[model samples]
Target chain A: MALKPYIVNTGIITAIGNNTQQCKDALLSGKNNIGKPTHLKTHWESEIPVAEIKLSNKALADMAGVNEEWPRTALLSAVAVKEAWLPYAEIATGLRTGFFSANTVGGMDLTEGVYREFKETGTVSNISSVINHECGAITELVAKHFKIEDFVTTISTACSSSANSIMMAAQMIEAGMLDIAIAGGADSLSKFTLNGFNTLMILDRQSCQPFDNNRRGLNLGEGAGYVVLMNDKAMAQCNATAICTVSGYANANDAYHQTASSPDGIGNKLAMTQAISKAGIQPSDISYINLHGTGTANNDSSEGKAIEGVFSGNVPMASSTKSFTGHTLGASGGVEAVFSAIAIRDGVVFPNMRWETQMEDVNWKPVTELQTGIAIDHVLSNSFGFGGNCSSLVFSKS
Target chain B: MDIYIKGTGIISAAGDNSEGTFLHEPPTYDTDKLLSKEPNYTAYIQPMQLRRMSKAVRMGIGASRMAMQQAGVEKPDAMSLGTAMGCLQDTEHFLAKMVTQEEQMLTPTSFIQSTHNTVGGQIALLAGCYGHNLTYVHRGHSFEHAMINAQLYLNDHPTHNILVGGIDELTDSSLQVMKATGVYRKANSTEQILNTNEPGSLAGEGATFFVVDKNPSEGSLHIKGIGISTPEDTAAAAAQLDKFMQQQGLSNTDIDLVMSGWNGNSSGKEFYDNINERFSASSIAGFKHLSGEYATASAFGLGMTMEIVKHGAVPAHMLLNGKQPKALKNILLINSYGHYLSIWHITA
Candidate 1:
């Protein structure tokens, strides 16, 4: 038998809820608590909306049991990973453990603030404030908290980062290098990313309308998500139930534009087709798809076209959960992966909220209502990013 | 499957070896900063396109192109790059504008180019490659982790050509920040970095790329293994290396050379000394003095070791303890940042 990366556990902290069960309840009840932010200190707070977790940094630290002085990205990552590792705690005693994380912003939330003060004063009392500025430092913070030292690294491929992190963990497990891996990503709302997206004209002022022809752009959200992947040997050594198997994954580049998707969705098509092919299944075998719908015109059109290409018009039940959580950037992959796992485990699919119209480019409509009593044997998840970094992952019920 | 390096390219303080222009700049032998000596990027990228690129992207593109040309591969099956603090120049650019402009009227150019994977993405764009792309951002093991991924890719697809590398750029603001954080030296350290009394290591930066595959080509260099050890682990770094060596069907005595990443801090002198004693038969060489120090400096160390493999002898200045090994076949590269270590087993 081929080596498989079985997902043993998952954890998440999004706007809809703080834990997996809470988020599941929200998804089941069709609740999208995305609105104006009450915490993020942005001048456009009232003008542009976001899907922010209603917790202060101190509160998040209290949840993570770490210092509040750490970067918000790290804080978010530690909380999610801690939850993910809770069940598998010391079961990994004899296993080679790894932590593969992802994040785009690093510590810019704190760095930007410290930098402004440093520029104005030419001096600051503390310089360690910016010490966690590197993406690796975020991983380090969480790794130290958990004592996972066999391997540690962060992938920063924009939005598809956490997806790639999960993929690498699977690959390493298959390569017989690691026995277990906690893979995912985290990103906190910051002036840097918010303003950057604003300049790109991709930040929707109101709630996002994914897969709708009249869609403008995406609403930026903040949170973290993680999954515990274990090989068969590690599974034999541990006492945990398998949630799902990381069946297949592919990371393909657009090679078209730095931050825009190709009109033909060549890279998107490759990602979807290759992932399905790697899973050794036909396109129709997939029961549901978690779309990478960022509500942007380019993303929806290109992604829809790619879906059409992959399924040949017989589209599977698919929906973009971004309407519920907004576009979480680096954290989107992990957050959605957790959803995919839960979907397969519980036999359900969440709805894409505010998906009012069909995109003219493709002939399909996303699932708009909560679904139950369905066989979600295989779930495909997509995560694409700027610089044309595109990735898709397939999860199957274990 | 034996992972082999088909071609190598680098843009660094030492210069671009594939372009046959090394030591063009005044050597940064006695300085606290060792910046890469970039080639004329017009040869690889358009002048207009090059104008919009940051220092990191330019070097990444330049080095990857040279590597592709040398390997006779126009499009690779995948690109895996490791950058510790990726695209720092553009990151600082966007951060500066956001702070000074009060978060309004920010241009998207710098922000667009500020992503950690921009260099890898740009390389894909130039090659029109729609293959696997990844960027690892660990502190010291960044490049090693990339190589590990490439090895796994080669293990799965033996015929696939993969472009793998690491990059880090030393921007002015980044250097200033490092100095303030005491990660960089406040004053001039010893030119002889190995014997230095300095408190902090120098900050250096560069980009190095390699086209690797399962099958060997002309003058191919083989990678026996690449593994990393974290300080938080209960096992010692020596145990990690010994276990890796055992997996590769070798022992400490089989290693002909040990290229150590001694970061010029006397606090680590005892550690390197212990390493020197363990590999008693191997020649100990230091490269931080030549390449300075950075997260991916080990990649530069690998680059220099590849050069030695091509020339069939280690440089005299690099050798710290023993004379150049006669056979230069088995080599071990131990890169350390703090107590984190990455061991690369190489063969000619």
Candidate 2:
């Protein structure tokens, strides 16, 4: 049986902008949002650069229409989910709408702050409510806010959380289990994540440089992105235009170390191969590749090697959009999925912002400049996270 | 659609691995306190690898290896794992180091093992099974997410086997936090879990794995369907169960056994009471009394249901009612955790 293609109607909220149009304009104008961290205070603020969203917790809570005391993670997620569902709210009213969200750190920002207060004063008044910082709390918040009652789930495979969320949503829709799915991921900047990465020596002190020979490590970013996936029946009822069709997607585990990809990129190869096979397309059919280049030494090299092994000389015009938007962890997959859809819709190739040099291990260079008016029929986006959770999704123009 | 459970394994406070877990009687633990027994990590995992692994990953890999061995397969087509609070031990470790050590001489081990997918990825690497791998961490419905994904994989690729499991570990701090929040019962409570009027239940953790395929193996159990919902409406949940059972072309009478996630609390018991009344003729079993109440306790319930179907008898202790069906054809396992409700159907 032929699988039905799910279309993407994305809602994006990033440090770059609020909506799709503003994000696109920011991307084209080369406006970067890397600056000092104000919403979050950290000891490493003097040394590190982050892509922090300027919105305050109260402002985000107001936008989400939740109470003033809602968890920061909930507020951020509500903003993204509200934007994604506004256009399709009525169609989802009577139908079975499921939500799948991924977050690496659930309410760490709130917990860390409260923990600090407790340590200082030995009182627990401030952070008692945010104690439910586990993976499910934020997901329940979204499900409640959207009034989605069926099949709400959360996936947290580290950085691949959102990618896996999107993949699972597609599988559920294909299995005739759901009619529409709001699938994506969100994560906020927290001292726990920052110090965790910093302790691992993976936090680049300056701006992150992906696909570069001297790329040190990744600079963490925080945001949320979601896409509304409507099945054929739901799409017909709403008369919605598909930005692109999710033709193929596959997830493979590297079985390597906890944080590093395999040197051979076997897992990466398997994911891409399976995705292409599922899409029923040839390797040459892919025109754009959104590499999960996290600016880390291990990721860029292994990902590049994997791409070379698969495509060889015919590598697609690829770039690490993470260079523009710092690795958003769980939200990277959703954010990049939206970007891939934009590439297909606008027929343009976004640049790899700081790719002045390519690694010596692979014979490939990212599309360094924004190339407009290109015939991009298929876009393959890759998201690999800790625990070797590797996933690839192939999006094609409708 | 036609997914068969070829092999299954479990390691929890109840027992070590599959053989030990199934043969021994489930252990009784306090309902309102933390329950965990230290397993000898050296027997299942290498010291070097186990040095930095959190309890969740350690138990998860052990269970996965046991399942693979039972299935007698080198690699599965896909791997899926579910967890609520993923790698909390390592997460807590990293957080403490960051604050105390000032992030100076931090090793990458804890940080690396802190992610939720560490167990699934490690299992893949250990078994050399580089297939579709995913980890779901949706509080109570974590295992359901994995089971649903595994079902979809079986539906898509009928020829392949998928390894799915759910794992959670209780950390002292986390347990303390839950206790502080009034989610756990008082330590001295002596009332039976099913009859208890307490407000909270005990906290425990474990790992359970299943090798699901379209082809039936030597003692295969068939997974029929799964359904999940939140705590917004208990009546709605009961209605959803009715519809789900109807969709499977089965009535409440066809259900021979029901395994419930009754965790010795007033609300939890009430939820099970509603389910039990619906299947009044079927023998009911409770698990959290043995495994304790964790987010992924449903996986333990699934393991217990598999044992009941395989052994053709309800282990004397698990039965709520003395009645046992002559032939076990259908088993409905229901679990509600962290404001979410899930139901799974399995048959032999």
Candidate 3:
């Protein structure tokens, strides 16, 4: 039996835009949505810029067509998924539909607000329903609301959670177990995440600059991105426009450290090598690479080394779009996946914003200008997260 | 299509690994309570690494090490793990510190260790196995997802040995919050798990690991097939099981033992009862009584099934039915986690 290819129809909700078109437009224009935090309140608001969705929880809830009491994380997920699935709802229905989503800090925004109240007064008031903040709860909400009755699961591999989710969905589809899968991730900014990253001393007080010598750190962002994957049969029946085919994907652990990638990028090299092999393509065939440039000192340097190791001196045109979107954490993979599909569909590569001096460690430069009318074929996206979770996805023009 | 369970290990509130856990009587839980014992993780983990790992990682490492050692493979072809809560204790710790410390001078250790793939990544790192590595964190069906991935890897590659497991740990804050939200059983309930009328089940945590391969080792249990279904899809699950058995040219009667995830929660137990009514004639056993109710408790069941198939003997304490099959040939392990039902068919 031949392995089935899993294709992505992505939906996105971010500070830059609400749907895929808006995100594409934002990327093409090199618009950065990083600014003062609006939806969330934190003491660091004055010091750091974040890519926050301007809508309030109530507004987002209404947008998702849910009750007012839904958690912000669930609301964001529903909105992104709604947009992603609307075009393919007919195809999704009556199939072996599975929901595999991920979020780093699930429902923590609600929990933080409630904890504050509980701390102030012994009585926990209207925030009583915020208790289903476990890792799988958000995906459960999306699966239940969408009436997806097949294999529903959630991934919480921190920043790389959604990438791993997408990878798992593809593996399942390849195994001929499920017909369709909605795989992606969502994460709303919480005082919890903001503060956690802040405490780690990795948060930049200014805008994030990836692969730059003077880069400070990452700017946190909140949003959700989802991709609807279908088997060939479902695709034929739905006649869905295939934006890009998930030609190759691989996940490997660095096993080097808890939070840091190995200096040699062994895990990253393994993942990239495996993915290229799975795609039945050579490293030279990859035209564009979406680097997991978190703008943090550790990530950019390590990822640069990994890229160099994989492609040697003959590197593909690569850039870290994180300069525009910041590090979206769990949603980064899905978001970048959307960007990757757009890159392939439009045959254009978005420029990496805010690059100044090159890193002294490894001599790698990001695509600095929007290049159009290029014969782009395959785009490789990398997402490396804490716990040495490293993943690479190869997307090709359909 | 031929997969084998060459070796297995488990670390739960019940005990440390398969040898330590299965050799003794099943551990009993207090009514509507979670397990509270902390395993001596230092036995398996280095001190420096142990300093950063959370309970989930510790349990996972302990069980994974045991599985690798028992399988007599220094390094496996691949490593995979399933986790629902990931590292909640670490997540919660970081969250609390973030709020209390006002985001100043925060160490990255907890934040770093709090990912869902830590177990799988750590296992691969410790074992120095650079082969395929992945983590599945879908709730209720995490272990099933991992198993499916393992099967796929086996199908595609000629590699023989694979390490797969599921690990979930309960934190005090998570338990407290779950209790407050009515997802946990109320305190002081005298009702046994299966007989309980309450809506919630007790919370628990553990890790279970298996050394799987396409070719059977000296003492191997054949992993015939695996089936999974989303929440409340018991009919689909049963049908899938039936189809799997039929494809394997086996029947319900051919199954010498059925290990059910009767977690004492109303819904979980109800699902187990449904399976029981369908396979009442088969010798049925339960593991939640020993492992407690967590997303990956089914992993404990898998570990047990591997042992029963290899040893040709069921632990007396795990035997729910007095009738013991003279010689174990086929065993069915069923578990419902989060919102999915997973069935594993193993034959000796």
Which regions of candidate 3 are displaced past 4 Å? A1-8, A91-94, A116-128, B18-21, B26-39, B102-105, B186-199, B231-250, B266-278
**Lowest lDDT 10-mer window, candidate 3 chain B?**
B187-196
How does chain A of every candidate compare to the true chain A by TM-score?
Answer: 0.98, 0.96, 0.97
Which 10 successive residues of model 3 chain A have the least lDDT summed? A122-131
Model 2: how large is the Cα RMSD against the reference?
2.2
Which parts of model 2 have CA positions greater than 4 angstroms off? A116-123, A127-129, B20-31, B38-43, B102-104, B188-191
Alpha carbon deviation, residue A365, candidate 2 (Å): 1.1
Distance from true position, residue B130, model 3, in Å? 3.4
DockQ of 2: 0.69
For candidate 1, what is the DockQ? Answer: 0.81
Steric clashes per prediction = 1, 1, 4
Interface RMSD (Å) of candidate 2: 1.9
Question: Across residues A281-345, which tens digit of lDDT does each residue of candidate 3 receive?
Answer: 99999999999989998888888998998998888999888877778898888888888888888
Candidate 3 or 2, higher TM-score = 2
TM-score of chain B taken alone, every candidate: 0.93, 0.93, 0.90
Model 3 lDDT tens row, B1-348: 577887787777667653443545655545556563556766678999788777888888888888888888778888777887788888778766766766676777777666677777778778777676777766777787788778877777766578999988887666766676666766533237656666777777888888888887667888777777663465655676677678778777777788877666665554567777777678887777666678888888888777666566777777666556655777888777645677777777
Q: For residue B311, what is the lDDT in candidate 3? A: 60
Q: Please give the ranking of all candidate structures by lDDT, highest first, separated by commas.
A: 1, 2, 3
